[model samples]
Each structure stands twice: as structure tokens, then as C-alpha cells.
Target: MISAQLPILQVLLPLLAAPLCAILRGRALPHALSVGTVLLSLLVTVGLLIRVESTGTISYAIGGWPPPIGIEYRVDQLSVIVLLIIQGVAAAVLVGGGASIVREIEATRAPLFYALFLLNLTGLTGMVLTGDLFNLFVFLEISSLSTYVLVALGTDRRALLAAYQYLVIGTVGATFYVIGVGLLYMMTGTLNMADLADRVAGVEESTTIRTAFAFMIIGIGVKLGMMPVHFWLPNAYARAPSVVSAFLAATSTKVAVYIMLRVVFEIFGVPMFLATHLSEIIIGLGILAMVVASVTAIFQDDVKRLLAYSSLAQIGYILFAFGLATEPGVTASVLHLFNHGLMKGALFLALAAVALRAGRTRRTDLDGLGQAMPLTMLGFTLAGLSLIGVPGTVGFISKWYLLEAAFDRDGFIIAAIILGSSLLAILYVWPLVERAYFRKRDPALPPVEEAPLPMLIGIWLLVGANLLFGVWPDLATGLAERSALLLLGGAR
Candidate 1:
């Protein structure tokens, strides 16, 4: 039955569509195929989430082979929620991304571009679905490779350099990750996550295991763009085509965070993670990222770069909450993960609209855009408010849960720091409004109307979710609570 096959079908839909996209003859067909693929994948993902809620975790083995021997695809409360985030964002960006894509990417390369996007989706989804650590590495590379190519496809010449930088660093990260996986396999003799979880208990004290743990964290942290290792993100987002910027910003690092969660809590066990005081180090890094990245963002002239740096600060929030690992803390972390995706997706898609009409995305380039493109700028403003954690927005809801978690732990300084860091968001966020609404339009700039309808739909869809979840957050909160419990229970 279709219900029983949801796990594989969720992955296979995008996987099959990717190759078809590469060979498609024309722009419309490939774009439609990409949109349809992601839409179908989203539905499958939704079904998978519902089934998991009703029946608990679902594990599907490949080739009728049992888990620990055959490759397995597992869906649980945590993975299913993450799957929803991935497919949901992917669908929104693709369905509404056509105008931006046509503007930036050459018509000749359209099919391949769609191909890479679907491949990227396949890999990210697979990374969430797979039950083997080594399999995760494989999926990680698939997504990373596709992402590097997609970054290179930007109309801006700097995009190639940005892609190269990410390639060099991403390759290093992947190497570190694979080495860690190899060490884990050597010690436990199994790559299956469930089996390794059982086997790792006996060897938790081994020096090799400890070293492997460190390697994994460093590797995943680089992919996560956590503070010092984030050299590639700003330029990459700044130079890449607006749609690529939107998609990767919204989904890529979020998936890496999910992978980190699975490895840290489910595979390695939280007690071991906490015993090393790595949790403290993580919280410290989060705090530093919050203050430092927000400050750095305030200086950026390019809109995408500004948001990219802001993303690091947001990542810091997620990291800080994750390190707390209490039910409330983890709940906040999970909620913020999804909420942040909506925020970034809306912002970047709006950037695409800016580039389409204004010829660029610099702060100065946006003068009088509020009048020329009222809908797009207003949507951007709403998403920016979410980023700043304004009341009645998803961003505010995330911060509310985060503050509650910090108070539960009696960490007033952490709570103060969280609130103070959001104030920094205002510094960067306000200028966008100021430039759009207050300044006179430059005489030389061409007269322009609103962005194409498809693109506007994409931008506003995410903005609507920002408000919808902000005002009615029961669904996101319920999922986050279940995922938080699953993570905490798995750690124990």
C-alpha cells in the first residue's frame, strides 16, 4: 500500500525527478517537473509525519534485509518533523521561484539547475531519513556537491569563487566527517545507527571513541557555519542567485543541525556529551555567535550578506537551546529550527524580487523600493520583523520558548543575552525599512512594477506562515514537544 511505502517514496520521488529534469528539453517542462516533484515529496512527507504520530516510529529496511544488516530508513517524531521542514521549504521555494531563476540562470542551463536542486533535496531528505551513519555521509556529499554547483550557477562572477571556497572547506568538512564515521565503524563494527547506539555503550570510555566524537562535532560544526568556520556563508549567499540563496539558507544548515542532534543525542548519548563539558563549550560558542554575528551583520551593505550573518546569530540561538537539552530547551530549539526556515526563505525570496526590479540587493540599491514594489518590500518587512522576534510572529514565539527554557534552568544571564542579542537584530533589520520607505527614489533607476506573480506567491507564502505560526503555533509547538521528548529519551 502507498501508506506502507511512504518512507522510500518520499526520497524516491525527488531522486527520480532529478535525472528527468536534467534531460528535459525546455524551461517550462523542467520547472514544472521540479515543482511537481517537490510538491509530491511534501505530501509524502506529510503523510509520513501523520503516520509517525499515529503509530510511533516507522523503520523500513532495504531489500527485505533486517536492520543492522541492510540499509534502513527510519521515521520518528524528530526525523519526521525535520522532514516536514525540508519538504515544506523545498516546495515553497520551487513552486514560487521561477521568476528569480529565469532572471539569474541562463536558459541553456535551466534543466541542469533544476536537476541539481532536486538532487540537493534528495540528499537532504535522505540524510534525515537514513538509519546508517556512513549512509548519512553519502547523502551529505550528494547535497554538498549539488549546492556547490548551484552556487556556481549564479549570474554574478563572484559566485564561482564562492563556490570554490565552499568546495575546499566543504570537502575538508566531509573528510573529517567520514574519518569520524570510519572510526565509529571500526569500534562498533556496524554503520547502522540503531545498532551502533547499542554497541557504543560498551565502548563509550575508549579513547578512539572520544576522538571520533570530537571529529564528528568539528565536521558537523563547519557545515553548521558555527562562528569561526563560517567564512564561506556570507559571500556564498551574497553572490549566489537569489533563489539558491533562499533555498540553501532556509534548508541546508538546518539539516546539518538535525544531523548533529541525531549524532550527539541518539548515537553518542547526552551523558557522554555532557561529561566532557562540550555542552558548556557549545553554549559559550552560541553566546559568542549571538553577540558577534549580529554585530557583524549590522555592517554589511549587501542584503543577502546581512541576512547571512544574521543566520549565524540565529544558529547560535538554536545551539544554545540545544545545549540545554531539557524538554523546554530542546522544544525551543526544534521550534526555532522550523521558524527560522520560514524567516530566511521569505527574506531571500523577497531579495530575488529586489534583484529582478532594482538591478541589485545593496542597502543603497533599495531606495524608494517601498513605493515601487510595495508588496515585496512590505513582505520583506514582515519577515524582518519575524527575524527580530517581534510579537505575534513566529520569531517571537521561538524566543518566548527559549526564554522560558533559560528561566527553567535558572540561567538569567543566558536569558538576558538572548533578549539583548535580538536587539542587535533590530539594528540590521531597521535599515532595510529605512532605505525602502524613507529615501527618495534614484532618478536613474529604471521604473519597475512588482515581481512576477509566482515569485510573489513564494515570498508571501513564507510570510503568511510566519504570521500563521506566530499567531497559531499549536501545530509547530506540538511537533517540537514530541521531538524534544524523543531526543531526550533517546539520550537516556
Candidate 2:
């Protein structure tokens, strides 16, 4: 009986624990609750994944009611991978990122930080699991609102402005999504995603439905930090406390991408993708994001900002894969979803350790400190290599899939562009290597040692995953393939 409730329990646990963390209102208690909640959530996801694989999609209704009337939580191939990434990142970052969080956030506010962090996780998990369109927006707000506070918890004064900027932008994005949902509700008289999917086909040809689709996509795009609308991300990531940046960068946009997949492929359906003339637009934007964001990253002096821009570029590749709307393309997008999470989690967590030792993460701050912080720098290096799509790394697995999709979709030209854009990763990534290992230390700062053991273990967990999955990618690949087929099936 309890097994049937995993779908709701996965989200409910974090949702309930968040307020308890706030109520307890102390460092140790809140931290323990946050860590315990995340670890429990991760275990729940694993169990759900096992059940979904053996039995197909699992849908649980709330209050003893059925779907289209009661709120529903759905777990399937598409959602499980992302839920795993979210909770896994949270467990790793929360358990190990404690030192960095304490260093950056005031001791007084640390309890609140843990509380907000749990709420953020709750929102992200709810967003992935909910089958109600309206509830998804609620979760989006829950997550976004929590994130705004988390970002502002940074020691820097600029964190306030960054959080404000994101808050304003994020609200606008949410409003746009709600407007779309309202239109759908009016048309179908239902807020359930499965119900809407069934009823939408009759009215999708209408102008109002088309407008709703466009609005929802743009709204989700803003949240995902899609190109041209992504000005808020770099500063937000740069100014947030180190652990917050690591968690948000690794989890937030990746989940938004999945929401896009669910919305565009499953809800709007693929016929609409091509029929509405949005496919080329999505593909073009992806191309622009890859080229433009990568170029922008090469000029960033702040290591966190550099990684932020790199993330935008990574989102482009995922979008491009999805724009193709083919089995291979969808598969590539899902694969990148899992793989990019591993590498970015590793990179950002390593940056957390870097900031702890060096005081700042500017290009200058890392100079010759590689010798001082070998394990931290080493993790950063491995993650960076994966970003560059180097062989025997998870980054390579993502690129290889993207290349395959490109080759199928447009032949040599798009494939060439994919390869060329990957070269841009090298340009941004190499500078850190040059500064960290090549230059001598400035001799002004005091001697420093490697990152804390917990931090190093967390970073290596992700880094090890990058290599293990790269070498033996069958598990991730298998799941991606199945998820993609289901996604493409709806579109077809």
C-alpha cells in the first residue's frame, strides 16, 4: 500500500520538511532536516524509477479522487531521470556543501537558508511530478520564490539586486504561463494535463489555443534561461552563495527543459511543432544560444559567471536536439539532460571549494592555486574536460548524441556547426587551466590547503559519474532511449 504512494511521497516529504526546517530555526536542526529530506527524496525517486520501469507510468490521485478532478502525481521514464538528478544533486550538495554555505551565509540566516533550500527542492520535485497544469504553475512559483531568497542570502550586497532582478523577471515568466493555462482551462474546462491532452486536439487549430501554446513556451523559455531572454542568469549565478549557485545551476534549468519537452511534445504535440512553424524558430534560437553564449563565456572573468554562460550554451544543445522532434533528437536531448547535470554539478561544487580556498573565483584568483587546491582543481579540470566534450567523459556522450541527431536532421552543415560550437567550450575552459596550473601564485594571499573532505567526496561522486557513465553509458542511454520514444510517440 505504501509502495503505491511513492509518487506523492517523493514530493510530499520535502514539502512538509521545509516548514519544519524553518520552524526549528537553527543551523544543526535545519541542516539535518534538509539533508535527511533530500536523501529520502532521492531514495523515493530510485524506487519510483524501479516501479515505473517494471510497470510503466505510475499515476497517483489525491484525496481518494481520480484524475481530471483530483490533483495527480505522475511518474514515468521522462520524469524519473530528472527527479533523480534533482534529489541526487541536493543530497550531494547539502551533505557536503555545508562548509561553503556556512562560510558565505551568516550564521544567523543559515537556518532560513536551509529552509528555503528545502522549499526550492520541493518546488522542483513538484514541478516534475504534478499532472495538473495549474499545480505545475504553483510549484513553479514555489520554487522560483524560494530561489529568489536563496540567491539573496549571499554575503555580497549585489546579491540583493540580483535576487530582485530574478524575482521581477521570474514573476513575469510565471504570469505568462498562468495566462496560457487560463486559456486552456477555458477551452477544455479542465486543469489536468492528461485531460487537456485528450481534449486539446479538437481545439488546437484555434487561434486562442495557438496563442496559449506560444505563451507557455515563451514563459518556460524565460525560466529555463533561453537565449535572448536569459540576461538574468549570469549575475544571479555569480552573486548567489556558492552552494546555492551549484544547486540551482545544476537542477533548475534542466527541469525547465523537461517541462518544455512535456509541454511541446506531449501537450502541444509534434504536429503542432512543425505545423505552427515554431520548429525552425526553436532550432534557430538553439543555434544562436550555442554560438552567442559560448562566445560571451570566453570573456567572463568570474568563474561562476563563466559557468553560467556555459550553461546557456548547454541548454542550446538540448533545445536543438528537441527541435528536430525525431526519436534520435529527443533521445539526445534526454541524454544531455542527465549527462549535463552530472558535469555541471561537478563543476559548480568544485567552484564552491575553489571559492572557499581562494576567497574569490575570478580568473586571477585561481592563478597557480591548482597546486594549493589540487583535489578541488582536479575535480574542476575533469568537469571542464567533460564540458569540452573530451573523450571518456560524460560531455563526450552528450556531444556524440547531438552529433548523431544533427547528422540525421540536417547532414554535414548543422553537424559542422555542432562541432564548431563545441570548440568554443574549449576556449572558455582553457583559460582556467592556464591560470590555475600555469601561473605562479600572487604571493599575497596566505597559504591554503585543499577543499574539505565532504566537499571533495561530493564533487568526486559527480565526477566519477561523468566518467563511469561515459565509459559504460548503457544505463543512462537505455533510459533516455525509452523516454525519447515515448516523447516522440506523443508528437507523432
Candidate 3:
């Protein structure tokens, strides 16, 4: 029975716990409930992943209704991998964020905050698990709405403005997505993804289908922070509560990428997508994002803002890989998705520790932090190296696959661009390293200490993951290879 209900339980557990969190009276209770809920979901996701690996895809229909009519929850190689990342990161953030939240958020609002956090988790998990296009939009809104509130919960007044900006842009993106879904539904008379995939193949040459594809990509691109549509990300991350920043940085955009992958390969069919100029256009925009966003990150004064821009650049790398449309290319993209989550989650959690002790994460404020908060800064450094794609880091593994994919395509220029982009990451990361290690401490500032043990544990958990996955990448690489094969095979 437990094995049979894993799909619904993965989503329902969090959905039920969220309301319980809201009704809970105290900070500790809500925090425990939220963390427990996320951890439980994580365990379920692990079970689902193992089951999928051993037994193939698991599909559970709602109300015993069949496909093309009743809603379905499907677990496959791709969905399970994404589910593990999402829940794993959420659990870590909640655990590590406890002390920081006490300092940054009002005590009275803590329950509400945790409630919203769980709701966000529910939406993200549902978005990946559901096999219906309309249900995807519903889950997307649930997540997006909760995220907007959580972003606004920060102490900074600017958080409100940041949340507002994200709300406007996010709504527009969702609207565009639904319009596309509506178009597809009208053309095919069904919203089930598998059914749509079958139906869409027959209308591959229709102008309506092509137009729907355009709308869907642009819509999802905004959510994924694709360059030119990424203006809302920097401020949102920089201003939101640190935990919220870490959670969003780690999981949200990756879900958008998963949706894009589903739409591209499962619904639209890769052959049709690649046949037009769309692939080239996506690749060009991705390259532009890699170069332009990295350059922009180098000049940012706020550390969170800098990391936010860096994320935009990293998204470019994933898009660049996906644009290649080959087995190796998709593998690199999927691998990077998991690796980036580890790197960014550690970085943001470390920064949260910094904010708790050092007040702010501006470059100037972080000067000489290596002496006062060595462990936190050390974790930051390790994650930074991963960002730079240094040897023995998870970042290197992804870049290695990406470079191989580029070479496989015989695109020497694209490979050069990949190498050049890593240099830009070093350029931006080095100044922070120097400030932490070499700059003199200000005598007037209060004496500071390392982050609390709980926070340090969270930071190092991900830091250790970075090193473990980096040194022995077979786990991530093998899973990615299987996922890529599944996607490519399905596309045909």
C-alpha cells in the first residue's frame, strides 16, 4: 500500500502539513513540523527514485480514472531526480534556516512563514509530479504565490517591492503559459501530457501548434530566468529572507527547466523543435546570458545579488546544453541541475550564516570574515570553487560533460565559450576570497563568532556533498545518463 501510494503521498504529505503549520501556535512547533514534513517527503522521493530505477515508471491515476481524462501522477527517471533535489534542498534549508529565521523574522509570523514554505514545497513537487498540463499551471501558481509572500516576509522593506516585482513578472509568465496550454487543449481536446504528446505529433505542422510552442517557451523562460527576461531575479534574491533566497536559488528555477524539458521533448517533440530556427535562437540567447550575466555579476556590491546574477549565467549553461539536443548534451544539462543545487544551496546558507553574525553580505561588510567566521567562510569558499569548476568539485563534472558535448557537436567555438565563462566566474569569485582572507578587520566592529552549530552542519552537509559528488561522480553521472537516454528516446 505504501509503495502504491508513493506518488500522491509525496505531494499530499506537504500539502497537509502546511495547514497544520499555519494553525500551530509557536515557532518551534511549526519549524519542526515543516522540517519533518520536508524530510518525510525527501524519504518518499528516495523510495520513488529507487522504485522507478528498478521497476520503470510509476503512474497513479486519481479516482481510478484512466488517462486523457482523470489526473495522473507519474514518476520517471527525470521526475524522480528532480523530486529528490527539490525535497532534499528544502529539508536542508529549513534545518539550517532556523536560527537565522529567529533573528530575521518576527516571532509572531514564524508559523505563517513555515506554512508558506511548505506550501511552496507542495506546489513545486506537484508541478514536477503531475502529468496534466492544466494541473502543472495550478501547481505553478500555488508555488509562485507562496514564494511571493515568503519573499515579502523579510525584514527589509525593499523585500516588499522585490516581492511585488516578482509577482508581476511571474503572473505574466504564468498567464503566457496558460494561454499556450489553452491553445494546445483547444487543438488536441485533451490536457493530459502523454495524450497531448500523442495528439501533438499529428498536428506537428500546424501553425497553431507552432504558435503555442513560442508562447510556452517564452513563458517558461521568464520563470527560468533566461537572460533578457531575468531582471526580476537579482533584487528578489538579494532582498528576500536568506532562507527564502537559498530555497528559491536551489530548487525553483530548476523546476522551470524540468517543465521546459517536458514541453520540448515530451509534448512538442524534439525533432520538430530542432527543425526550425528555435534551437539556434535558444543557443544564441544562452551564450549571451553566460557572457553578459557573468560580467554583470562581477560588478555587483551585494553578495546575494552577485550570486543571483551568477545563477542566471549558470542557467545559460543548462540552456546551452539542452540546445545541443544530443544525448550527452541533455546529460550535461541534467547533471548541472543537480550540481548547481548543491553549490548554490551551500553558498546561500553560508551567506545566511554571515548575515546572522556579520549583519550583511556586501563585499565591504564581509572583509576579514575569514578570521571571525572561518567555518562559514570556508564553506563559502568550497562552494565558490565548485562555481569556478575547479577540479574535484561537482561543478567540474558538469562542465566536463558539457565540454564533451560541445566537442561532440564539433562546435569548437561553443567549447571555447564554455571555458571563457568559467574564467568570468573566477573573476567575480576572487574578489570575495581576497576580501575575506586578506583585508584587515575594522577595530570598531563588534567581536563576531562562527555561525551556530546547526547552521554549520547544514552548510557542511551540502559542502560535503559538493566534494563527494565531485570526487566520485558515478552516482550523479549515471542517473543523468539514464535520464538523458529516457528523454531522448521518448523524443523520438
TM-score for each model: 0.99, 0.98, 0.99
| Top-lDDT candidate index | 3
For each candidate, the alpha-carbon lDDT, in order, equals: 0.91, 0.90, 0.92
Q: What order do candidates take by lDDT, descending?
A: 3, 1, 2
Candidate 3: where is the Cα deviation over 4 Å? Answer: none
Any residue pairs clashing in model 3, and if so which? none
lDDT per residue as tens, model 2, 223-269: 99989799999989999999999999999999899999998888889
Q: Which whole-number lDDT from 0 to 100 does residue 216 have in model 2?
A: 96
Clash tally, candidates in order: 0, 0, 0
Candidate 3 lDDT over 1-492, as tens digits, reads 788999999999999999999999879999988888988898999899889989998889977898778999888888987887898889888888899999998988999999999999999999999999999999999999999999999888999999999999999999999999999988999999988988999888988999899999999999999888999999899999999999999999999999998999889878887887788888888899999999999999999999999999999999999888889999999999999999999999999999999898889878899999999999999999999999999999989999999999998999999999999999999999899999976879887899999899889988999999999998789888888998888745
Write down the RMSD of all candidates, one decimal each: 1.0, 1.1, 0.9
Clashes of 3: 0
- Cα shift from native, residue 346, model 1 (Å): 0.6
* Candidate 1 per-residue C-alpha lDDT over 1-492 given as tens digits, one digit per residue, 9 for 90 to 100: 889999999889999999999999779999999998998998898899889989999999877899889999999988887888788888888877898888888899999999999999999999999998888999999999999999999888889999999999999998999989999989999999888888999999999999899999999999989877989988888888888899999999999999988898888988888887989988898899999999999999888899999999999999999988788988999999999999999999899899988888889988999999999999999999999999999999999999999999999999999999999999999988998999988888778788888888888889999999999999899989988888878645
Q: Which of candidates 1 and 2 is the stronger one according to lDDT?
A: 1
